[model samples]
Target chain A: MTRMLTFLVVAAAAITIAACDTTGEQAMVPGAKYSMNVEDGRFHNIHATGQKLACETCHAGTEYQPDFVTLSKYADDGGASPGIVDRAACLGCHKAGGIATAWYGGRATR
Target chain B: MVKFIRMIDMERCIGCRACVAACYTENYHTSGAPWNAVIEHEIGTYPNTGLAYMPINCMHCEDPPCKKVCDDMGAHAISKNEFGVVLIDYEKCDGCKYCAAVCPYGVPQYNETMMELYPGKGRTPYENVSDTDRHPTHRKKPKVMEKCTFCWHKLEKAVADGKTDRIGRDPEYTPSCDVVCPVNARLFGDIEDPNSAVAKGIGAKKATQIKKEYGTRPQVYYALVGGDF
Candidate 1:
């Protein structure tokens, strides 16, 4: 009984650790991990129009690219999604008093 | 013993982006690597809301964290000159970006690809210059970290010509962004010289460097919105 309890406790701790790592990587997807889409319901839920945006809507643009140095900290690959460079795409809906959260000049604070 | 520094009066900034445009044009930076940026933040709340604009560049600290990290990684690409300007040698940069990870200000920008200024349209006249003809700072390469050099190219020319006295007073010797400020919000000169405009401004305005807790001892000072501490 002692052996079984110890094994179960160790297994639970391991699972918790793994779960935390995954959560840390996924929590700030819109800011850091834009390349990897989150299965969270908020990923495509455009606020005002209630439109479900396709990946291309935000990912298709070469005009502005992500600051690779900043992105690399979050994404191990050290690169943003193809054509999804800077926050230019999200600015359309993420400015002051915009449909989504306020993000300006690499800051998401208000 | 001349330590160059910049003093920005943020109280006078109108967020026109003229300084940003000037830096981009003067440096001829490719897409994604802006040497200067004007960060906007919504301050206060409700009816008391206000927008604060902070024009930031490389802090060019007395003890730069970027240089420390780069040197630790055995890159040794980052160097601080006698004039107190921090610069990166493009050739020596391995693009490992360890410096980027440590920088408190998020100053280093990694250029993955040298994209055209006007994408799909073509390179601008500024971008079309040959590497041989351009200043070393302007000779940008892909897959390397880049940041503002405090317009070291122009400052170097002043030193070469023995006209360091003309630095803050003349456009040829001044940082491009400082030279183009519509409002006289930007001042660049020798901070070590007690009589210099920047030094006097620092005293008169009680100018303070941002992120003081970092202990980097930045050369860039700002007359902040509320008050300089």
Candidate 2:
């Protein structure tokens, strides 16, 4: 009985360790081997007017690309006008009055 | 001291965004982080209007604010490599967002959720790719504040391959964005090399760094849109 209890305890610990390793759920990426603390999700509320998209959501990549054009057209057309966004396309991810809605509201008028 | 420099000719820049894409693919570990950015501003009054496209990357300042603040935390999260490149150690970063807030250029980006490239499936190209494989000169830590390594990985690879002299001149050693630029507006090379195209261009055009008042002493130089008066 004593042996069985010890085995079970060790097995449980092993399983927990294996689970964490497999998931890579730790704050840092697995095997990266560096130390830099950065906020993972602070810009969720910030959204653009035309697309109502956060800068990170679309521009998220390893290196920067200069070919991104979706926002350029909107910027060109709207010129100085605010809020003249494509509402139908924006509503796909952001429902009316969501965090995005408030953010876009301010940018559209700016 | 051998200094490196990047030169941007606004007249030749067509705003293709190749640099932004290369940055994304190379630094996918920080999936939502932007190491390079392009800001388009309209200049002049109505009828004679024009659009100015500015591609901004980490200034790699001589006195980088990001490095100063990171050091203030006593963590020494940021450091300048031997080549004068500012880099962040992801493992030490506590997700504090302090560096991101202090950057005047709004270059550093934050990632909130740890996203798996292929959630249900196993690792994908998006998951396995690192800065080393992407550029060969820049190696980035995942889940950290990653920005442009200025294609340092490529530079390192060139040196290892006994091709140090070929850097900036060789397309493979150049940053993906710089290589893919159809208009040939962006130029990269050792600023210390007097014969390099970047040096010649800078000497010929009187290239200038952005927001010099900030005293960052950015290595990246630019030739303004309007002809020098």
Candidate 3:
């Protein structure tokens, strides 16, 4: 009986630790290898807006320096005319349920 | 011995926000954090109402309140270099935001998260680009207060590249916003150099600085559309 009780306590502690580690991983933004995605997007969006230019206009796969993967999978799909992005493309990352929407609430109409 | 100055012609400004956009792209790291702001104010009652578009940026003052408050905090993070550029050292800053709180112009911005200007180059957003490709004029830290450096990096590059004569003349060296102005409403150059176009333009226009009562003595001069606006 004593041995069984000790085993049960150790198992519970292990499960708790495992749960915490998994939670931490899930909380992290996906595809965020080096930088926080939110902050990166903020700078990118600001620059695009400030220049009166679109992100896809310069950074599309056709551009000399393309980092479409940083934006969305749509660009990765090799769709032509990446120069002009629409609400659908924007919503992929900035979805209503995404971390970005949660932080900014609603998108600016520009 | 040249003092830098900017002249903004309000009469020619169409409120297209091209200058604002150019400023953001050139200084994307601090882009959303506006160094130049466009405030649209309307005057008059009905059909005769007129809209005034005012673009505001850091004065780079003779006696900057932001610097005074930073000095008072004992941090001394903000200071005016010999060229009259107001700069903040992020490494020395404790993110106390004391400078932001006291800035009458509201130029300082507190960056909470790390942002990568050049993405997907094996660089983390939190990593400071100033550590590697140090901006020719100003050094930037990941998390700190930052504002418009007036494209100091480009200016320094031009000087280093032995194009000192083109400091104010080169469009690439010019602040992105100033260069992108469709109507040629913005002028940038050394104020002390009477020959420079910016100085001559402001002199001819009788340009005025905003909020002169604060005594910031801003380098940015504006030719307002109407009197006392």
Candidate 4:
């Protein structure tokens, strides 16, 4: 009886903590707290926009490593990409002089 | 406000190719491909033919066709910096040859095979050493586009060291190809500075960009050339 009561209390507490985590995801570009790093993306708000999205939906990388980032097919040890994102991955949607500017501003490289 | 450019005086060039050796050492180019080279052009009749040794490299065009094509291919690895230096981002490059195809100067060299700088002799000190602070450009991979960056690392170092004035004047800051010219044929400096050697050479020798008709607007100029770009 004591074990059953403890389990019920723990479950109720876990639910309360989860509910208090956040009211809702916001809509807009990510703020300073967010990071676009590959590991833990700051795409929470983006993800909350009524669709389950994978990185490959936009990144579309190589055959070996399919994402926006082009990882080496040979090894998993090396630091393939240092830290910065490949802005080029967004070119599919935001072409030069289209709704968005090119990767390097004022260049109009495309 | 600085427009960097190089002026090659063909009248003074003897094609020693010392610059090539220097570049090979500086750039870790142990492969079959060369980042800089001298093109030997033969002029006039066979019986009375003459030779011209034209040094060829990335023109660093004002309107680069290479970058445009790379962008179109969606690789977006090529970038022309504010200093007019053209660079290829290796990590983002998908081994696309669009840049190489559209370049009028044929400057973008792709290394398909991996080779050592010295097979029997062993690795270079720079190669063997692990330097986290080394410039990223030095770590370029094979199968990606490569070209003359006008010794961009050196220039960036110069800037970081607050010695921008030392560039083109100091051997440490200047391009290896520019400094290694035995006959002093290759000139590098800001064309915007009328007092600079490159500007004076361009003015005095009537230097012209290669393939101006192509409208590439190449920053590299040739002075006293016998043939067209």
- Model 1's CAPRI class? incorrect
Residues B70-112, model 4: lDDT tens digits: 6755667888888888888888876656566456576888777
lDDT of 2: 0.61
Interface RMSD, candidates in the order listed: 12.3, 14.6, 16.6, 11.4
Specify the highest-lDDT model's number. 1
My TM-score estimates for the predictions, one after another, are 0.68, 0.61, 0.60, 0.66
**Candidate 1: stretches off by over 4 Å:** A1-110, B226-229
Candidate 2 falls in which docking quality class?
A: incorrect
lDDT of 4 by residue, A1-110 (tens): 99999999999999877655543323222322333233354443333332244544443552224542354456582333333334344444434454532322224342
Best by TM-score: 1
Which lDDT tens digits does candidate 1 get at residues B44-133?
779998887889999998767677656645678899887888999999987766566556677999898999877899777778889999
- Per-chain TM-score, chain A, candidate 3: 0.31
Candidate 4, residue A10: lDDT: 100
What's the C-alpha lDDT at position B69 in model 2? 55
Over the stretch A1-110, how does candidate 2's per-residue lDDT look in tens digits?
Answer: 99999999999999999776554344222112232332333232223322245443533422323444345654543223232233233333433255432211111100
Misplaced by over 4 Å in model 2 are: A1-110, B29-31, B116-123, B129-143, B226-229
Count of clashing pairs, candidate 2: 46
The superposed Cα distance between candidate 1 and the true structure at residue B108, in angstroms, equals 0.6
* Better TM-score candidate (1, 2): 1
Whole-model lDDT, model 4:
0.70
> How would you encode candidate 3's per-residue C-alpha lDDT over A1-110 as one tens digit per residue?
99999999999999988776554443432222222133355334333433334555444445433554365655444553344333234334333355432211232110
lDDT at position B93, candidate 4? 77
The order of the candidates by DockQ, greatest first, is 1, 2, 4, 3
